[model samples]
Target: MAAKRILIVDDDADIREATQICLEITGEWEVLMAEDGVEGLAIAQLEKPDAILLDMMLPGMDGLTILKKLREQVETQTIPIVILTATAQPNERKNFDQLKVAAVITKPYDPMTISDQIMSVLLTSR
Candidate 1:
């Protein structure tokens, strides 16, 4: 099978680079990245990646807005989205759950297990 493609949308260059390095080292998937929501949305539409890892807080547009827009479009509606956020409040979690996001990953994530965690979500989703 072809390696799964993941589009990672984050405003932080360091986070993006770290995620890319971690995911690539596993050799199980291909990674694409965008610095902001606008670019992220464009890449998503053009690439149609298998999954999206979107940062909840962004400069151009916030993650919730991006999620809403993606859900509205037919091409992107079915793609799984994992929200990456630094906020881990219960209310935020509840809201994200209501939005039907695939998962919420807190920032300062475990580099060693991030790929495995994502893969687990994908497998179970199937």
Candidate 2:
């Protein structure tokens, strides 16, 4: 079976690198990254990755806007989206739930367990 491909969209280079390293090493998944929302959205459309790990706060577009745009397009509508947030506020969580996001992973996450969390969320979402 082919390994799962995941796209991570975040402005923080450190977050993107750490996530890429962890997912690649621990989950054995292909990791694609984008530093800003515009690039992230473009990559999502072009790559069609199996899942998306999107940062809630971003430059140029923000996560909610990107999520809405992804949902509006047929090519990306069905892709599972896991939100990476520093603060999962009640209202934001509600919005994410309404948008049918896969999960909301709070930031400052444990690198050792991040892959497991992502994998588990994807499985349960399916």
User: Which numbered prediction scores highest in lDDT against the true structure?
Assistant: 2
TM-score of 2: 0.96
In model 2, the runs with Cα more than 4 Å from the true position are none
lDDT value for model 2? 0.91
How do the predictions measure up, each by TM-score?
0.93, 0.96
Tens-place lDDT per residue, model 1, 2-104, is 8899999999999998898888887477999999989999999999999999998899688889988888888898888999988868887887777678888
Runs in model 1 deviating more than 4 A are: none
- Positional deviation of 27 in candidate 2, in angstroms? 0.4
On residues 48-93, what C-alpha lDDT tens digit does candidate 2 reach at each position? Answer: 9999999989988999999999999999999999999889889998
Model 1 CA lDDT for position 25: 85
The clash count of every prediction, one per candidate, is 0, 0
Q: Please report, in order, the local distance difference test score of every candidate based on alpha carbons.
A: 0.88, 0.91
Backbone clashes counted, model 1: 0
Instruction: In model 1, state the lDDT of residue 123.
Output: 80
